[model samples]
Target: MTRRPRVLPLEAPLHEAARIMRDEGIGDVLVTLGGRLCGLVTDRDIVIRGVAERRDAAHTTLGEVCSAALVTVGPDDDLGTAARLMRDQAVRRLPVVDAERRPVGIVSIGDLARVDGLGPGVLAGICQAPPNV
Candidate 1:
């Protein structure tokens, strides 16, 4: 899990968020509203919802593209729980949150692939797939 998650306000520009993801070498970032975790946005979201839609990145807001129906896990939740949530939601990532629903960290399918004994073959398949844009 990445403890220091990249966070941005809901009104942040889509292009700026994409640049931050590229610079941080991360596929997703936490989106906040009034200093609370409100949602999350991924590279795939940017490509499909922003670029592919031809929405001006500089004008588009994270609130317009982020996954607002969040699938999150508490900080103390077990890895199995996290995996189950991911599978049930068909999402690749989950934001670890605190009691107040504040994002504490971020976890991805890749983070569990090896430790969960889902071999490299499976991991590679997931990582190598192109964005569904």
Candidate 2:
């Protein structure tokens, strides 16, 4: 899991999110409201929901496009649980949160692939699974 996952306020602009992703070399950001995790905005969301829609990046807020139906895990959760959640949710990433729903870290498919025994096969299953549509 990537500790200290990047975060931004719900009111932050799309351009700001893009800049943070570019500067941090990350693909997504946890969106917060009153210091609690409320949503997630990925690079793909920025393109498909913001840019592709022809919205003004500087004016459009993350809350407007972020995926608000969050599926998260706690820091103590095991990799197997994380993998199952990701597969079931059709998500590539899961925010690791504290008791207060504050993000503490992030687990990604790449992170799972690094595990000794749970490697490519798990990833392949996730990748090969049909879309949640």
lDDT of 2 at 62: 97
| Cα lDDT computed for each candidate against the true fold | 0.88, 0.91
Model 1 segments more than 4 A misplaced: 117-133
Quote model 2's TM-score: 0.87
Task: State the lDDT of candidate 1 residue by residue for 1-133, as single tens digits.
Answer: 7697999999999998899888867789899987789999999999999989999999999999998999899989999999899999998899998988788998888777746564577775776566554
- For 1-133, candidate 2 gives per-residue lDDT tens digits of 9999999999999999999888767789999999999999999999999999999999999999999998999999999999999999999999999999999999988787766485467665765465453
**Residue 44 in candidate 1 has what lDDT?**
95
Candidate 1, pairs of clashing residues: none
Per-candidate TM-score against the hidden true structure? 0.86, 0.87
Q: What are the per-model numbers of colliding residue pairs? A: 0, 0
